[model samples]
Target: MVIATGTLLLALPVASETGQPVKIVDALFTATSATCVTGLITVDTPTTYSLFGEIVIMALIQTGGLGFMTLSTLVALLLGKRITLKERLVMQEALNQLTVEGVVRLSRYVLFFTFLTEGLGALLLGLRFSRDMPPGQAFYFGVFHAVSAFCNAGFSLFSANLMDYRGDLLVNLVITALIILGGLGFSVVADVYTKRSWQRLSLHSKIVIRTTMWLIIIGTLMFLALEYTNSKSLAPLPLGEKVLASYFQAVTPRTAGFNTLNIGDLRPVTLLLIIILMFIGASPGSTGGGIKTSTFTTIAVAVWSIIQGKCDIEIFGRRLPRGTVLKALAVASVSLLLVVTVTGIMLVTEQEEMEIILFEVVSAFGTVGLSAGLTPQLTVAGKLLITATMYSGRVGPLTLAFAIAQRLGRQGIKHYPEEGVIIG
Candidate 1:
């Protein structure tokens, strides 16, 4: 569904002011980048694409961020049609619903919650934007950015992204709010809305909430402390501005590409911190992509258990299932391998600094979109590689692997014994 939608959008006829056709490769690349929410672009989006093209791209980003199934389900509900059991099952899987019976209700809630939060975010952003832009343009910019931030789509009309508004408290707060809500998995958000308390939350919600808070707090402090004296970026800012910038940067890296400062100017330690946050990405069943906060938490718990010589992994005073722990480890391992391989390929194909290339590659694979200014100079091969990385990041490496596994195997009763080799 994603590939088809992206391809069709790319194939749509777009022309310059003189009626010349836009290059097909550029269209394809941009379509893939936006639909996958990777944010790597060969050409500057605001300058290269016509207004119509920009709208089309934005629509695609929203659709892709909200899964095709979810959008179709909403349309079905709007048309007053009853969804079938089979359809509900698919929707349940697509939205990662806990059960099949509540699929319709869950879908409705998801849609409502998404729009409500986005609307509020847009209003706040628009109020701030009016200080610099006309009311009409400000409103549109606010709506566009709200949608983009919540979707984790990373598409921006501003050439420098949110850097110009770094010190604007209203803009920073609005964008950060959108990013946080988007990064929290839909399931967690739904739980919050329905339950309204930490005690009443599901185990998944508990894990996501704790993991997200920890990452943000630790990440912000690390960036601030590491980059405080770096002359290129953070040093010159006033203390208050530096704190705001640090927090914004910390929040943006978790699978939302909007930047408040020059990424290329960041100190190495800050870059490393950002990379870690990007690798963690957003939670499951959300607009953002990564191994997910729950997965990260599960892995951490498992590691802690092993280090403490305990057998079972426990968190929030509850023991996680063995299968869950294993799955988390598997996803993390696969994601790491994908990032390393893609980074190596980019190094060979693009003559850029190691930090920049690594940042680009990891950002692409994590769907974080925090580039170090190396995106525009990528070769054709490099672009294609990134396109693939973005797709995998969005769909998930483990999910794709499972799809391939199903094709290669039937029900199997045979098992191979596992063996341990070397210690770390």
Candidate 2:
């Protein structure tokens, strides 16, 4: 529903002041990108899309980031209607809640939390934007950017993204804050608000919080060390500016695409770092995509357990469930396979370099939006591949494939025993 509505909006004359009709494929592509919160674009957004078009894109990003089911629940609440049990089940799935019983309350919390964070983020960003833009325009820019940042959607009205204000402390802080809040997973935020103590938080919340903090800190340091003296981009910057730039770049790739540095100018090592970050992505139940941080953490723990010759994975004094570890492995393996296959196809169809194709594939799968300056140059086939990748990344490949492939069948009586395999 979100995709269709967004596509229609993109096609409508009201969305663009240019008076030129956008091609259907382009419209569909843009809509899918916006609705999936992936920032790949065939056309330059700021130049091709007028203010009206920008607003439509922003709306689509908002709805997509929040999930369509959450938006529907909000509307139902606004109309003073009761949410049915069936609707609650759907909401549970949409929000990735533990159970369907308290979906009504969960929906309310989601809406409330979203508005609160976005509102605060806008106020901070608006104060900074007022220095350059007129009050009204600044306010609009602030609101749009705040929502985009919080959603980790990576769509920006400014043609240069955050590059123009790369060293601006206020801009850096505000945008990073929004991105962190959005990528931290709503459930973690909710738990922090309700529990008011770290020790009282659930296991999921603990893992997410710990993993996110570690990633941000380690990522920031690694980026600073790797790029500080690189002549292409970071070398000329002052100490403080370099640190700030590194921090921003570090945070941006955890599924947010805003860049303070020229992506194409980065060292190969920095690009590799970005690929790892994008692959891990934001926490589960967050607006961002990729395999997710929890999955990464689980995989890491599982690997450690194997190295220690342990039969079971454990973390933070708790035994990890077998099913959880299996799921994480499955998700990571599938994500990697998808990226490799898509990258290979792109390489054959497009004449771009391996680096560019790999970057595009990772960007699509991660929904990270960072590019090797090749997004606008993609051929029709490349664009379609990216669109499919973005959709699969957002909906999840396994779920979407299963939904299409599912069939009713009787259980087989025969059972096969597990067999030992050759070790490496």
Candidate 3:
């Protein structure tokens, strides 16, 4: 519904710079990308859209990043309306919480943390941007980027994204911080905020934090090593700038999408590594999207358990539930199927290289938004395909599957004699 509304708004003549109604296909693509918080664009954002259009995009980003239910809950709170059990359950589902208990309270924390973090980010970015432009323009850029960064929506007023600010320490630090915080999942942030110690945090929080930290660290080092001598990417910069750029690149592919380095210029190995990171994107209940870090980690541990001939998957001193492991595998399987199916279809429909097509497909599925300069050149078929991919990524493949399954009605499980088929 939000995407539909945004599409209509963006299709208006006032939305374009030339006072012409944008093509329905382009408008739908932009609306889906914005609402999904995916940075893919069919047209140049700054050049194609007027202030009204930009504002509409920004609003969609905000609305999409934080799910609509969260915003509706905020409205209810402001109206002094009590959150009933049904609303709590909806909030639980929306926030990906395990239970409805304390979901309303969590909603409060989500809003508070969102505004507080974005405000500080805006202030810091505004200060840094003021040096490059007039105060008003700088402030506008700051606020826009801050919200975009915090929401993990990679929309930029500048055509080059953050490439121009690649070496600027302040911009890199502030934007990466916002991306990391936003990608951490609000539950993890809330856990850290309330617990204030690692030992006291929930297992989910612990896993997410550990997985995120290790990903960033390993991704940064690998990018630095692989692109160290590649003239197109990290090679031309000084050591410090190289590391900085590598770090920013590492951080962005985790569903953040703000690239300080040229994504298309990176080596194939680096791109493959980034594709892996993008596939295992931010945690649940966060602005960003993917199969999720937790799901990825769970799958990894499950594989380890299988290799070790263990029946149960254990992590962080606790055995994972059978259902939890199954769900993780289910989500990963569904996500992989989606990516593979889309890439296969695109290969037949479009003329892009296999690697480029795969990257675009994964980026769309992950909602990571980093394109290899192929977005603008995509055919109408490609655009619609990616638009659908973005929406599915945002809503989650498992959720979509479950919705379909529910509509098919419940089936009773039959007790059958168990037999082993074969082992691979």
Candidate 4:
């Protein structure tokens, strides 16, 4: 519904640079990308959209990134209306909480954290941008990019999309810091804020923190090694810029989608590595999207336990519930199937190479907007396919399935005696 409304608004003549309504396909594509917080663009944002259009897009990105439920809750609070049980249930599902306990308080925290963080980012970025442009324009740019980065929505007002700022330390540091904070789920941030001790944090927070750190470290090292000598990417830069670019590229694939390096110029191996990182995306209850860090870590822990011939999956001194393990595996399986099916369809319908098509499809599915220069040239069918993927990725495969099942009426569990199948 939000995307539909955004589509209608963007299709207005007031939203375009030439005082004409954008084509329906283009409007819908842009709306989906912004509302899903995916940075993919069929039209160059700065060149195609007027100031009014840019403001609309930024609004959509903020609404999409913080999520519909979170905003609605804030509105309800402002209205002094009580949150009924039904609303609490909806909030629970929207925030990916395990229960309804403290959901309202959490919503308050979400709004507070979001505004405070975005404000700080905007101040820093605005001060930096003021050096390059007039104060008013600098402030606007700072606010737009700060919201975009904090929401993990990579939409940029600049035509080159931060490529010109690749060597600017302040820009890189501020943007990456916002991306990391946004990708680290709000619940984790709240936990850290309140507890301020690693040992006192919840098990989920521990796993998410550990997994995110390891992925960033590994991705940075791998990117540096693989693209270190590739002239098109990292080789021409001085050692410091190369390292900076490596870190930026590494972090962006975790569903932030801002790129300081040309994504198309990377080697096949480097691209494949990025695919893996995008697939495992941000943690749950965060602005970003993907299968999620918790999901990936749960699956890995389960596999490790099996390999060790252990009966239980244990992490951070707590044994995971059987249902948690099952849900994690289910999410991964469904995500893989969705990615494979979408990639296959694109390959059949589009004239692009296998690698390019696969990359685009994964980018859509992960809501990680880095493209191999394929987004703007997509055919109508390709655009529609990607739009649907962005929506699905943002909502999550399992959540979509659950919604469908509920619409069709819930089915009761029916268990039968198990018979072992042949082992691999």
The best candidate by lDDT is 4
Going through the candidates in order, what is the number of backbone clashes in each?
0, 0, 0, 0
Local error of candidate 3 at residue 321 (angstroms): 0.4
Candidate 1 residues lying further than 4 Å off, grouped into runs, are 1-19, 398-422
lDDT tens string, model 1, 163-228?
888898888888888889988978888789889988999999998898899898988898899999
Off by over 4 Å in 2: 397-414
lDDT of each: 0.82, 0.85, 0.90, 0.90
Clashing pairs in 2: none
Off by over 4 Å in 3: 398-414
Report the Cα lDDT for residue 342, model 4: 87
Q: Candidate 1's error at 341, in angstroms?
A: 1.3
RMSD of each: 2.6, 2.5, 2.0, 2.1
Lowest summed lDDT window (length 10), candidate 4 = 401-410
The reply for model 4, stretches above 4 Å from the true place, is 398-415
lDDT of 1: 0.82
Per-residue lDDT of candidate 2, residues 113-230 (tens digit): 8999999988988888999989899988999999889889888878888899999999999999889889988888888999999789988999999998888899999999998889
Cα lDDT, model 1, residue 120: 92
Better of 1 and 3 by TM-score: 3
13-116, model 3: which lDDT tens digit per residue? 99999998999999999999989998889899999998899989999999998889999999999999999999898888889887789998999999999999
